[model samples]
Target chain A: MVTVTLNGLSVDLRDRAVLHGISATLRPGELTGIIGPNGAGKSTLVRALLGLIPATRGAVEIDGHDIARMTPKALARLVSYLPQGQALHWPLSVERLVALGRLPGLGPMSRLGADDLAAVHAAMKRADVLHLAGRTATELSGGERARVMLARALAVGAPGLVADEPLAALDPGHQIDVMELLAAEANSGALVVTVLHDLTMAARYCKRLLLVDRGMLVAQGSPQEVLTSDRLRAVYGVTGRIEFGGGSAMVVPLERV
Target chain B: MPEIPVLRARNRALIPLLLLGIALVAIASLMLGAVPIPTARLLDAALGHGDPVVRAILLELRLPRTLVALMVGGMLGLAGAALQGYLRNPLAEPSVLGASNSAALGAVAAIYFGIGDYSPAVLPVLSILAALASLALLFVLAGRAEGPLALILAGIAVSTLAGAGISLALNLSPNPFAAMEIMAWLLGSIENRAMDHVWIALPCIVGGAALLLWDGRALDALSLGEDGARSLGVDLARTRARLLLGVAIGVGGAVAVSGSVGFVGLIVPHLVRPLTDRSPSAVLLPSFLGGAALLTGADILVRLIPTAGELKLGVVTAFLGVPVFLVHLLKERRLW
Candidate 1:
């Protein structure tokens, strides 16, 4: 597992500043959620960390080294990241699309080796998609596609993962299943940062919640400590009830204030 | 969601049909020609055989022409397949970059100035150089953002201007026979070509095809879109340069010898699509084989069609391809 540290991060997207001077240290083995309403720069912040978008005023260090100079394949192997929109290519079988995750480890002229196959099967199993391996990604339902996307990420088997809105279209059952998958990864000591719109899933699954508004972190703490009703009203402009029930605290978004 | 069994079965069935079509074309190519060479004599000639006249006719003329047709067709087919896969645009072909027109202009320039007759060897050299240079210029003009259609328009513009220049050059030529000569070359008949012409184009075509084969994985990534390919570590600039160079060498050399034959590249790939399991790699080699077969068959048809005069190979391919092109155009319009 590796830590990700963003220092004085500022991002300009096509001449507009999307992220402004945001800084955070993400700990290892933590299922951290970057929770915010739309246009809060959740996606921008993550994109910045991946070094996909150049940070205008700052830099990011992965485990104390600059990410600026790493080769693309090496960076991919070390840190797997999923952006907001999933790429839809050929309507390939789930097994084949997931196998694309093994590309960094394999050379151009080489076929998928035994280790690659095993890891793919394991990753698909981890994402609860073992049964759907033979199915085409395009043919799957939205939630099923989300899980398959998660499985593609899992197939990367990186030390850390940063996924944006991974649960946006998932149904409640798959949402819980996917959250459990993330929690399991963190429990196994991989740093997993997920950007989520569903506060309830974020509250129940992630150990740490980084709440942001207007490109700045408003709160960073445990779900119960950070997801207060007052915080929700101030940051998201929504009314919400944060109550401890059934052994876990749930942040239920009541209504827009 | 459960359209699985049907699609799988269709993919499988298409492969056999494509194979059968290719085989039938190949057999017909060997049998139907000017001499009416029987199968036994054909086999004997192929085996380097008994009658000196039959052996000479088969080995010297028929064999080389058939082989040239196959290779040229293969080159066009594979080139077209690679271009379409790279751009993800169905209309993409090597000619979209003006390689054919540039080659024609180079050959015409050589003939008009009496330079080709001065050194017979200089014609192909001039054609290859001009074609390669035009592709390089196109690479610069289009950059990465221009897709297949953009390339086509740029090529059309270049070709039209070059064609007008050819007309003027031919008109001003002192040799009265120059106009008829240029017209015949422009009409694109693969007649009186021998093993020497085949040898001239073989190395360039094969080398260019090797580069195209290197582009397979990258083309697969490009199907995801440019940004997607970049994310996967594809160096866009290098791939573009390689792609253009391959097109220039293979296509320019082809037009150098055959004089602007159209649609082998376009027709062969589309025809072979059924055999490739809908995979890019499957399309690549099969298109080559299928293209070779189609052109050879067309060449055989040119030989056998019993006209008062000989037929043009280009005319036959165009006749075969026009209906297919129109069908694709109509089908594509309805698809969208």
Candidate 2:
């Protein structure tokens, strides 16, 4: 299991600060939801965590190793990332697309081995895209594409999985399906983190929530402690109430504040 | 998921077929010319046992020309596949992106200024430098943008600028013969080339093609777009640098010897892509072989055609490439 820690992490893009000095510790074997309003620097934070962008200050550590000093291949072997609104540029087969996730583990001249193929098969099965293995990825529907991308990420077999807005184009049923998959992954002893916009899903599915607004970490706790109506009004500009149903909390927005 | 055995088998068969086509075309290239040799005599000459004249023509003249055509064509095709995969654009190629034209401009400058009289090496070295310059400009203009339109526009700017430079050199010639020489060279031909030209181009072409084919896996990961590929451990800045240097060295070496051959790069990948699994990596090797076959076959046709003067190889490739390119534009209009 891997533990990700952020110590006073700040990010600047194009000479403008997008994320302030924020610190948090995220543990494995739990699904943590990062919730924030639009343009709240959620994407920037995730990118910084993966070392896709340089941090203006401070550092991100995984299992006590600073990611700043880690090679891209080493970092990728530990953490898998799924970005938002990915567009397919080629007509690759689904199986081949998923097999690309094994790139971090592959040598420059090595072909895919039996272990790599097995990982691809398991990822496709888990993401429920096994039937689409032979289909061209570019021709799939948006929902099918989302799940296929999820399979591609899963094929990495990294201990930590970070997905940015995985459910944006998904239908409600597929949203629940994706959340359940992340929850199952966490239960199977992986660290699963998702940047979510849906408060209800975040509350119901995630074990803990990190709430941010305007680049600041406003709150971080369980669904009951972090989803307070007053905090929602102050941060999201929406008046909302947390309702208990079936042993979990769900946030329902009443009106714009 | 179970493997699709039929599809897998078909994909595996394509490489051998392509290699067979290249070999047959190479042999035909050796046999057919202004003076045709019978098959039995050709084989005898190949074994160094035929008439001296036949042996000289086969071993010295035809062999070097055939080798140059194959290497130049293979370089074009491999570079095209690599560029298209890296940029995620179907239309990306060395000529279209101005690397070939810039190299041609450099070669023309060397010839026009009489610097080529000093050494045969001056032409290729200067052409490679110029190709490197144009590729640097290409990345400066189009690298940060996300869409194909930006890259295409940048390519147009570079190509037009290089064309203008070439025209300027042609307009102000020292003599009529110099003007004629520039015009003929610009038409792109592999005729009358010797083994010296082959040796000059071979090292750079082989090295550049190695750099391109080495990035096959990185190209496959780039199908996920830049961010996704980066997250998967592809070093984007490094990949870009390697592609630029590779295309420059390869195209510069080719243009140094063959002049401004256009459209072979653009055409071969499109023809070979459908036969593979359609992944960027799967398209590289077949495209290389297909390119070799296409150019060798085209050279043989130029010899066979009954025109008073031999047709230029560039003209033939343009005729073959434009219609296919237009068809792609009409069919995949939504891609941009």
Candidate 3:
């Protein structure tokens, strides 16, 4: 299992501070959702955590190893990332696209071995894109593409998975399917961190939620603790009603505060 | 799924077939020059039993020309595929990206200043330096700009500036002979190129090609775009550095010898892409082989076309490349 530790993380983009000093310990075997409004530095936080972007004034440690000291391939073998709204530049087949996730594990001259193929097949089966393997990724429907991209991420077979807005542009049904898959992934004993926009979905699926507002972590706890009406009004600038029922929380924003 | 294996088998067969084609074309190139040698005589020459005149012609003249064509063409195609893959833009090629022109300008400067008269190495060295400068300029101008249009615009600007430099050198030449030499080189050809040219260019081209080929996996990852690729642990900075240096060296060596041959790089990859899986990495080796065949074939055509003066190899490539490029632009305007 992996534990991600953010130590006084701050990110400055072009001299403007986007993420202020924040620290949190994210444990594995849980689905943790980062929920925030637009321009809330949610994406930046994830990028910095994955070492895609350098932290301006802090350090990120994965299981006590400083991320800055780890090579990209080393970090990638530990955590797989799926960024939002990816554009396919080539008409690569779904199988080929998914196989790219194994890049971190393979050497420069090595071909995909049997184990790699098995991982690809397993990931495709898990993401329910096994049937679409022969088809071109560019021609797939929005929902199909989303799952294919997810399968690509899953093919990494890393201990930690960080996905940014995987539900964006997906239909409600597809959204539910994706959430179920992520939850299953967490249940299987992997760290699953997702940046989500749907509060109700986040509350229902994620075991823990980190509420970010203007680059600061306002609350970090169970959905009921973080989704309080006062915090919603102050951070989201909306008056929302949240009801806990059937072992889950349902959140609905009535109107702008 | 059955079709997948069949398709893969077909793709797998392409490289061997291309090699065979290059061999055939090289022989045809050897046999059918200004003074055509019959196959029997060509074979005899190969076995060292032919007439000494025929042997000299085969070994001295056509062999160097054919080797130069293959090397220059292969470098161009490889560099083109690498650039297109790195930028994720199909329009990126050595000439289109201003690499060839800048290298050509450097060679012209070398010749104009009489440094080339001192040694054959001076030309390619200066040209490689200029190509590196152009690539650096290209990154500074279009590196962060969004969309394919920005890169194309930056390339055009670089090409125009390099073209102006070449023109200024030509316009202020110390003698008419220097000006004429500069003009002929600008048109681009492999005619009368000796083993010296091949030796001068081969090392740089091979080194550059190695650098380009080394990053095939990284190029494949780049299909996901910068952020996604980075997330997958592809080092963008290192990949970009390799691409720039590779293209610069390859284009520099090519233009130093062949004098700014254009469109071979652009055309070969397009032709080879459909036969492969269409991954950026998959397109590379085939493009190189196809490019070698194309230039050798074009050089053969240069001999057979019955012109009062032999047509320059660069001019023929432009003639062959423009229509294909236009068709691509018309059919895939959205790609730009």
Interface RMSD of each: 5.3, 2.6, 2.9
Model 2, which residues run further than 4 Å from truth? B1-10, B118-121, B135-158, B324-336
Which clashing pairs does model 3 show?
Answer: none
Give the per-residue lDDT of model 1 (tens digit) for B54-127: 88877787666766787788788888998878767677776877788888889989988889987655777788
Q: Estimate each model's TM-score.
A: 0.81, 0.95, 0.94
Report the lDDT tens digits of candidate 3 across residue range B1-336.
Answer: 122232234366898999999999999999997799999999999998969999999999999999999999999988889888877878778777788889999999998999998987788789888988998998999887544567678888999999999999999999999999898888889998789889988988998898898888888888987777777788877787677678878888888889978889988888788777878988888888898999999889888898887689989999988898778667755433
Over 4 Å off in model 3, which ranges? Answer: B1-10, B118-121, B133-158, B174-177, B326-336
Flag the better candidate by TM-score, 1 or 2. 2
Clashing pairs in 1: none
Winning candidate number (TM-score): 2
In candidate 2, how many Å is residue B6 off?
A: 8.1
The digit string of per-residue lDDT tens for model 2 on B148-203 reads 56767887898899889999998998898888888888989999888888898998
Q: Would you list the rank order by lDDT, best first?
A: 3, 2, 1
lDDT of each: 0.75, 0.87, 0.87
TM-score of chain B of each: 0.86, 0.91, 0.89
Clashes of each: 0, 0, 0
State the lDDT of candidate 1 residue by residue for A123-228, as single tens digits: 8878878788767677789888888877777887788888888877677887887788888898899989999999888888888988878887778898888888
lDDT of 3 by residue, A75-146 (tens): 999999998896778888888899889999887656777788788888989999988988888889999999
Error of 1 at B46 (Å): 5.4
